[model samples]
Target: MDLYRSGDHYVLHADLPGVDPGSVEVSVEGGILTVKAQRSERTEHDVQWLASERFAGGYMRQLSLGDGIDSEHIAATYQNGVLTVTLPVVEKAKPRRIEITPGASEERKIIEPADAPEQANKT
Candidate 1:
C-alpha cells in the first residue's frame, strides 16, 4: 500500500492482481479505514506437482485517519487490478487567506448644550 497527498485529498493505492473486484471490501469506523480482499486458490486435481510462489489467501490493511481528514467524503475505486482510495481534507483544516482592513485614526470635538450653565470661576 502506498499513500500520498494530491491537491486537497490524500490518495492511497494498492496492488491486487489476480483478485476479483467483487471480493474486495472497504469500510471506515472510528476514524480508521480498513481494506479486505480474498484471493481464491486454484483447485486442480490432475495437475503435476510444481513450485508455487504466489500468495493466495485473505488480505487486509488498515489506516488511522487524523483530525484533518474528512472521513465522510472518502471514495474508492478499483481498476486494472489496482485499488485507489481518496481521502479529502476537512474544510476547517484547509488553509485560507484572511482579509485584513486598515484602521482609521480620527479625532472628534465635543459640543456643550445651550441650556447648560458655564463655569464662572477658573482655578
Candidate 2:
C-alpha cells in the first residue's frame, strides 16, 4: 500500500489483484479507516495443478486517522485491481495567509505624562 498527499487531500493506493470488486469494503469507525476484500481462485474437479502460489481468502487492513481529517467526506473507489482512498483535510488544518488590515497605525493617539503638563498642552 502507498499513501501520500496530493494537493488538499491524501491518497492511499493498494494493489488487490484478482479480488472481487463487490467484496471490497471501505469504512471508517471512530478514527480508524479499514479496507476489506476477498480473493478466490478458480477450481476444477478431477484436475491436476502444476503450481499454485496465489493468495485467496479474506484480506483486511486498517489505518489510524488522526486529527484534522474530514472523515465524513472521505471516499474510496476500486479500479483496475487498485483501491484508492481519498482523505480530505479540514479547512482549519490547511495553511492559509492571514490578510492584514491597513490603517491601524493611522488611528494612533498621542499620550503625554501627567507630570509633563507643558508637553501635553503643546500637543
Candidate 3:
C-alpha cells in the first residue's frame, strides 16, 4: 500500500494482482480506510508441470488516514490488477481572508470557527 498527498487530494494505491476485481471491497469508517481482496485458487488436475510457480492468497490492507479527508467523495478503481483509491482532501483549517479594512484590523479580533459549524451551514 502506498499513500501520497496531491493538491486537495489523498491517493492510496494498493497492488493487488491475481485477485478478482469484483470481489475486492474498499471502505472507510472512523477515518480508517480498509481494503479486502479475495483471490481464488487455481487447480491443476491430472496434469504435471515441470515448473509451476504462482502466488495465490487473500490480500487485505488497511490505512489510518490523516486529518482533512472528504470521505464521501472517495473513489476507487481497479485496472490492470492494480487498485487505485482516491480520497478528496477536506478543507484544512487555514487562514482565509476575512475582508477587513486596515482600520478594522485594530478593532476587530479574528476568530477561527470550528469545522462542525461550517459543515452544518453547508447542509
- Which residues of candidate 2, in runs, are more than 4 Å off? 98-123
For candidate 2, the per-residue lDDT at 27 reads 96
Per-residue CA lDDT of candidate 1, range 1-123, in tens?
999998899999999988899999888999889999999898878888689777899999999997999988999999998999999999898889999865576566565765344533332
Measured by lDDT, the strongest candidate is: 2
RMSD of candidate 2 to the truth, in angstroms, is 6.7
- In candidate 3, what are the lDDT values of residues 11-49, reduced to their tens digit? 888888888889999999998898999887778789888
Per-residue lDDT, model 2, residue 114, is 75
Please list the residue runs of candidate 3 whose C-alpha ends up more than 4 Å from where it truly belongs after superposition: 93-123
Candidate 1 C-alpha RMSD relative to the actual structure: 9.8
Q: What is the TM-score of each candidate against the true structure?
A: 0.76, 0.76, 0.70
lDDT of 2 by residue, 18-92 (tens): 999999999999999999999986777798989878898989999999987899999999999999999999888
Point out the worst 10-residue segment of candidate 2 by lDDT: 104-113
Evaluated at residue 87, the lDDT of candidate 1 is 96
The candidate 1 region of ten consecutive residues with least summed lDDT is 114-123
TM-score of 2: 0.76
